[model samples]
Target chain A: MMQQERTKVILGVIGADCHAVGNKILEHVITAAGYEVVNLGVLVPQEDFVNAAIETDAKAILVASLYGHGEIDCRGLRGRCEEAGIGDILLYVGGNLVVGKTDFHEVKEKFLEMGYNRVYEPGVLLERVIEDLQQDLQERGLSRD
Target chain B: MELKNKKWTHDQFYAIRGEVLNQWPTGAAVDFAEAVKYHENIPAKKHFAKQLVKAKKNGRTLTQPRAGVALINEHINLLNFLRTEGEADLLPTTIDSYTRQNQYAEAENGIEESKRAGRSLLNGFPAVNHGVAGVRKVIESVNGPLQVRHGTPDARLLGEITLAGGYTAYEGGGISYNIPYAKSVSLEKTIYDWQYCDRLVGIYAEHGIEINREPFGPLTGTLVPPSVSHAVAIIEGILAAEQGVKNITLGYGQCGNLFQDIAAIKALEQLAEEYLNNHGYPDCVLTTVFHQWMGGFPQDEAKAFGVISWGAAAAALAKATKVIVKTPHEALGIPTKEANAQGLKTTRQLINMLADQPFPLSIEVQSEIDIIKAETRCILDKVYELGNGDFAQGTVAAFAAGVLDVPFAPSRYTLNKILPARDNHGAVRLFDIGNLPFTQDIIDFHQAKMNERAKAEGRNASFQMVIDDIYAISKGRLVGRPH
Candidate 1:
């Protein structure tokens, strides 16, 4: 019998966003929960995400942007990923991702429309990402259990 | 930051090491490269040795990002934000100088408006300066080896000023504050108004004390370059002229801190040379603290700990009048009593080590001062830009437009957002000054762990509750605006 593919995720803050306090915390919890994670550090551009995914054959890309300018700075990232031929890679994002004050549902909807498979509002704890990852992996027939 | 001393131990060393290993692994270590040619040395103290050996065998790199992207990039982003938001319509100095350059009426009105906003400046200071009793207790606690001249009459009245320079440094205190003919405002009762200042200068001859004057001197033109920091020095000059007080200390921010600009060094130079000129009383100490605005960038706590300790040591080499070192975990949040105690004791050790090491200032250091002065003056210019015209919500709008050149804003993705990222280059060069005071004697993280152990044993340890309260009470609007 052929061995099944493993669930793996690549995560980082994208575009010109450089905040890392939250990024480090997320990395810690994600690793502890037993998913294989490739953390690309902060200020990753669109191409870096696509390149890392292609290089590592990652199943998803998780983006964190705390500077609040994620809307303007990160709008084209998903499209860039698709162009690099990894359109199927799942995308998850959270943290204080938009500038000024706004509703989180609206933000999630906007990012989802832009092609993210999963979107989290600011202060969405690390475990939520883990649960979503596990569920997604289960559906894909790749859960460790 | 604990206020007392501490020692290092194997278990504590291993504990912080395990945490470090969780991230750097043996194969992912990055930022500590050149400085830590002794990665082997990093793990030597006790438990860390095994981890380091394992990491070395596995080819671990510490995975620290480049400087601008994560470290010094905040400056350029701020600068760009300033440029894009647009320049200030009027220089505060021009208003102070009575130069109605262009749109003179607008300038005149702006000057008037700033004068009205005088109350806004003291956000934490009590509106009424009535807290001299508490201040007197603090003053009494302050001990100095220097004794005053015989027959120096008891001090009757005292005064202190904010010396608000422009930009991030002084902020509107210069031109509007230190007006040459500023009305001689009395202070005996405004302690409630400026309570945060905790400033006290005098007692009104009989019963109560007064801590008067909040003038911000703008020492422009031939006398000296009017950098925001220089404004504080100039104000000190004026304060020294008062005869009532026997001693004074400019309890300024970063007084016990370190920076690329060597700001404390310059402040000391100004104080030493100009104290007598202002006819200030003898024995005013210029103490500094262990603070860094950059620590918030969220690098490894261990590295931050080392940098702050080394920084104060360097500041002392510049011959600090006095110093205060913060505890290692301070950046995590407000320190507990134990943390404060540790911070004090750590600084005491660093100071003791540097005691015999006399500092010699040279033309080279002078050049660094000139560069930093110009750079921050440029920072002031950017701050002025954002003041009037940015259509966006303060800094947020400025960043979206890519008009900001400084990287003060910490985005979630620091790796690409900062260095080689165009606007952040200058900031890297500026902060590089901090790494210059190289030392082999300082055993890096393990040393800190050792000191921490000693501190905990001595009951001087503190655990700071790391505040994750990123939620703005104004619900994320600019402060003072009703949500």
Candidate 2:
């Protein structure tokens, strides 16, 4: 029997963040759930994500920032994605996203306004992410076999 | 370069010293002959190795806290406060991140900015930027013995400046510092660089100044198995002994399981001694340091103290030579001095109360120690075999082949094959053993433990357990039970 092609996803820690544990865990969880994850490890630039998304035609880009500098690192990232011609690609951001104890609702609203399709708080289980990914990919008509 | 576990000749070390001392302008201030004379003048009470030996002899667990600031006077004042208010038996000059990365110009700017702002903008003291004289001023002002603590992959320059300035103990190792701290640094390069740091300590030992050399034992402190850490600690201990370091302190981070934590310290001390003795370093005086929990803490201060006190209790019961204290403001960024003192006093209270009490060698702890020793032996034997009996080469090869993998490390060199999750009783067990050179019985033990937890949770043994365990402590529980 011919093997089915795996759905591709782009994942990395954004900006100067060097928190690789969560990023690596996310990659393992996502890949095990049957996606081909191009994990650009820690300290990744914004362009690298867009470039990888473009190069692999990834269905989604998962951005993680744990250094509490995600706000500054993630600014204008949506615009960069749009400029790179993958404007509609699903974007998910998570982790200790802000510098201090900000309300999760406020943080989520801010990321949504900045073009992320989903924003998760720190400690959100990866299984929940897989479920979200399944539903979102289905809604976008990018479902896998 | 073909790296061997051989000691560097005096000529080779001196040849490299010239280049190392030329790396920054501060390095020029390091006058070895003059530095030796200054070290000789440091009071016996302020000697780190001497204090550790005395503590070990008396069966006391000394307390130490990690503290540092940008400016010299402020740093000295902070150390004095910790010594007096916190009752910290040992003080640390934690190096700033820029200095750890060897960015002296950036660290210099941080110093200027901190001075103008009347506060430290840097996370730690920039000892290299301060040079030997600045370090000496802080050293002279502090009452207790001082240690230079930082997670630097290349600490050659920092070692030179700090040692010349009279700091008696230095922390970090090639494998320990690089695997956990750096994202892209190769193990070979770090192990090679750290050899220089160890050799510098060796030179001090040769001069009858027994500066303590500690291998940072908690590699990627996130749920690391005791065996993995023990293996790395033993390798580093052997490596340091080979370089002529006489006083060595191997350390372990608390794993949250009281029995396992105590057993880890015991196993580490025993394994380190065995490895060092077998490797022909019988004269080396070995000591053990237990680091308080290195994972995420509850944001609430009250809850944070609970975590700190638990660590303190474990350290005390384990009879660690010293316990590295953690502040109550761990979850928050850069704790205030008051909170730091509170953490220390809380720890000291526990240590004092538990001092006369003895922890019985229960079967649980003894079994944990036995298993850890067995697992550590497997890894070390593989490492020795891989290096064709050379630990330095074996360490690099072990990481390359995934035989000695650290869980959740940032380094690209680590295969990232292993996954760790706490068992039903909160003991760390490998959910996925990866390529760790474990025998079938060992693998079966971990698999059985993981299966037991899976059965209890009504869930299959999966990666979710790993994720849950990572956030367990912050959420106020040892095991991440499903709600």
TM-score of each: 0.32, 0.87
Cα lDDT tens digits, model 1, B16-57, are 333422321221222222212321222221111132233334
lDDT of 2 by residue, B3-111 (tens): 8899988987887888999999999999888888889999978989889998999999999998888899989999999999999999899887667778788688878
Worst 10 residues of 2 chain B by lDDT: B328-337
Task: Give the lDDT of residue B137 in candidate 2.
Answer: 96
Q: Which stretch of 10 consecutive residues in model 1 chain B shows the poorest summed lDDT?
A: B62-71
> What's model 1's overall lDDT?
0.35
Over 4 Å off, model 1? A1-6, B1-483
TM-score of 1: 0.32
* Per-candidate DockQ vs. reference: 0.04, 0.21
| Interface RMSD of candidate number 1 | 16.7
lDDT of 2: 0.88
Comparing only chain B with the true structure, the TM-scores of all models are 0.34, 0.99
Q: Alpha-carbon error at B120 in model 2, in Å?
A: 2.7
